[model samples]
Target: MEQDTNQNKVSKADSIRVKLYWRMAVMLLVIIVGILAMLAVIVTQGWSVYKRQSAWALASQKQAVWGLVNDARFKLEEVSNMQTELQVNLDPVFGSYIGAGSDFDQLKDRFGKNKGQFNASLKEIETQIKALRGTNGDFAKLGAAVRRDFNQYDRDTNKLLNAGDSGEDAVPYEQIEQDMVRTKKSLSALKARLDQERKAMGEVKALTIEDMARTLSILVGVIVVVIAALILISMFMIQNFTANMIKPLHESVRHARALAAGDLTRKLNFQPNRIITENSEIGSLCLSLQSMSEHLNAMLRQVDGSTQRVNLTSKEIRTSSR
Candidate 1:
């Protein structure tokens, strides 16, 4: 019987006591948990953004290099086209030198004008290629090669034009043209290389964009998960606290009210087999209310009995006198 009694006894807990310690501790724990969680999120997101921004800066640099390469290619095309016009004017200049086709001064002036324009384009290529090399170490070797090729081409073409200026007799046209043929070959190679680099940069830019998009999606998902977890945890904890403390206190108030209204017969705990255990402040209050009700009921019963006896005594005296 003793073992059964012990087994059936309600458990004791000191949580939700009159002291403020337990509630304060819960509040502090919640605050610390929230702050720590937010800090972790901020650190993680900040690092990711920093890395992505670095990549974007690198891409912008690549774009600058690409633009330079492309501009060099355009200038090369212009120089090549102008060379054809120089070729067309070559015959008239030679005829003028022989005293036959056109005025010598007019022919020379036209050829010189075209040559000046061609040289302008060559200078632009030189500047743009140098810019490409200076922009980044990766482009340095290619830029040097293009510059070397263009220098050789420029020298050879100038030699040919100077030979023409000397006279038809001094011009070794075929030999100079042969040497000049290889002049443009270097530029063609550079153009091909620029094409390849442009394609590669495009691919890298696309990949970077995709990576940033993926990281953004992951961050959003992590934030949503953290928020949802916090909300659910808070709800569960609040419900437990209400049940253990708030509900019990509310029940104690109702019991006290009934006693004050002379309803001493009403039970503190109306459950058939359950009793409010005196394990915390709320339970202690219910116990005190029960005690108060019992004493008041006893006093009221004594007063009622006395009143009935006095009335019976008065009626007996009246009957005897009659």
Candidate 2:
């Protein structure tokens, strides 16, 4: 019986330990899950920020390219206007060079200098357009077309300048105008494509940032729920452990105190058979107290019997002496 009681006690202790271990494991799992969720959220948010920054940078590049395109377009328009002015005045200048013969060389030199500057400007514009071409395939194609048109325009401008330098009457006004129109349209197309890309990039950035915020919010909510659950479960376990272990030990202490005061009449009433047989040290202690009380009761009964016999014997002797 004692061995069985010991085993039962061991079992109850093991049961409590198991409960504690399981609860601790559950809390650990919750903590780990919360940490992993937070890490995932951080990584996701970081990636979103990176993507947004990249998109913004690309949009800025596109805007800059658009400005360069406009600049090129204006340069082309200026070249076209200069060609028209030259065409209108070149014939009269050539006639005056032949008739007046004075200051003719100076006039030719000034016109040559102006033509050189215009050609240099056209070359610079071409270089900038080529630089923008590799940024987008469609832009490249449009830029190539623009380059072809501008090349033709440059050729016409050269032809007009050459005719004036040689005192010739022929000019390419019609061809120059056609080339200018095509160049303008191509520049417009390039700008339109850049604008479209920039707008799309902006939209993508907005959507990515919004999604990151939403996901972070949800993770935060999950963390809050996990923390709350951990707190609640901890409180419940504490209450249960205190009630089952501490309360029983306290009850055993009270019973032992009663036995210590020589109150053998007072029962060690650990109600509910399960509480007494719970394989706990407190239960065993309560049982020992009960056994002690039973032994004390038997001893008291024997002492009372002895006292009664002594009193009856003394009464008989007194009567016999009388």
Q: What would the TM-scores of all predictions be?
A: 0.57, 0.63
Per-prediction count of colliding residue pairs? 0, 1
* RMSD, candidate 1, Å: 8.6
> In candidate 2, what are the lDDT values of residues 108-137, reduced to their tens digit?
455456545645654554565555556556
Candidate 1: pairs in clash: none
Off by over 4 Å in 1: 1-74, 81-138, 155-183, 263-322
Q: In model 1, what lDDT does residue 105 have?
A: 47
lDDT of each: 0.58, 0.63
TM-score of 1: 0.57
lDDT accuracy of residue 276 in candidate 1: 33
